[model samples]
Target: NLRFNKVVICTDADVDGYQIRTLVLTMLYRLTPTLINKGYVYIAESPLYEINTKNKTYFAYTEPEKTDILRRIDGEKYTIQRSKGLGENDPEMMWLTTMSPESRRLIKVLPTDAERTAEVFDLLLGDNLQGRKDHIAEHGAEYLDDLDVS
Candidate 1:
């Protein structure tokens, strides 16, 4: 057994990513609420931007936000960078964006209706292929962009 000081879930900002994150959070909350309450788990803010400044650093979630933040800062002395994914960053950056509690963003898991959650989990991860297919087909249109046809 490994002793973990914290558990950080890093996922993409897509529907699939959201679903995976939700599933994990649900599992953790149900299985180990103490860990959650103790602040042992976090959801890393996958940087939408990698901004550098002389006095302060920032991570913006949108291009307009990045522009706004940049404008508010001393542009002459600051450098702005954008990160497409966590993989683009090095170990230190990853640690700064995800591992460091002070600088990172943590998403708390909330309790949900057990019956609905069970039904959803079963439909998504169950052994029944047709059930999964039907569930996907029903809600698939809304999240088509998340699917990789290839």
Candidate 2:
């Protein structure tokens, strides 16, 4: 853990991407709370789609951005490419959008509600099978299948 001063979690901008993130956070929160308390843990924001309009290139992080851009511009003239994950992005694209300090966004990990965060993490990642099942049921069907572990 001392090899690097900080840990920036880089994941896909997809459901499964966050699942992996949660698993890692669980480990960090439990085993290395110091990393989080000291603001050494971070989450990198990777845009979900890169939109190439006739005039300019745009990156959309959420559906609303894409919708807004489409409405503002002629949707027919732009190309939207879904980002599968970090692996699919070219090295330059990756550096510009995610790794670079000038344009990239990183959310530092800091638990505002430590008790609640710990409780929820335990409920989701703990050995409580019934709790996990109930939590899954409460979230609905896609919570189980929509995660992009691949």
Candidate 3:
């Protein structure tokens, strides 16, 4: 019995992250679509913001960007907040990072390819463990990253 008024999925910005988010969205769409129709589910954009200044904040999209930001902000005192995962944060942080409309980025849930999406959800989150394992084994290698291991 899911009583959530809004389901905010804050996953990483990688392939696995995308797959997980898709699976959850699919389950909700199948089981309780009213919530989705009412604009309840959201995909929270986990920040890649590294160098935050008083004037403007920057999000590092890649290692090169991170290096560039560091170089640009050299000798300037700025707060660096390294957010590893959403689980490391508390409810307040979650609200601030993912829930707040003013400060957070949320993507509306929309069904693109319903049939393929249904099959994906079934393979990923269904009762069959072997199906889940095989699915991951086949597609997971593409998204495997060292930073995503946590």
Q: Taking the tens digit of each residue's C-alpha lDDT, what string does model 2 give over 24-118?
A: 88778878888888878889999988888777888888889888877888645888889768998899999989999899988878865333567
Instruction: Please provide TM-scores, in order, for all candidate models, with all chains considered together.
Output: 0.57, 0.79, 0.54
Against the true structure, whose lDDT is highest? 2
How do the residues 72-96 of candidate 1 rate in per-residue lDDT, one tens digit apiece?
8843577766565666668887788
Clashes of 2: 1
TM-score between candidate 3 and the true structure: 0.54
lDDT of 2 at 62: 82
Reference-based lDDT, each prediction: 0.71, 0.82, 0.72
Best-matching candidate per TM-score:
2
lDDT of 2 at 130: 99
Mind sharing the TM-score for model 1? 0.57
Tell me the TM-score of model 2: 0.79
After superposing candidate 1 on the true structure, give the runs of residues whose Cα lies further than 4 Å from its correct spot: 1-6, 11-40, 52-57, 62-88, 113-119, 148-150
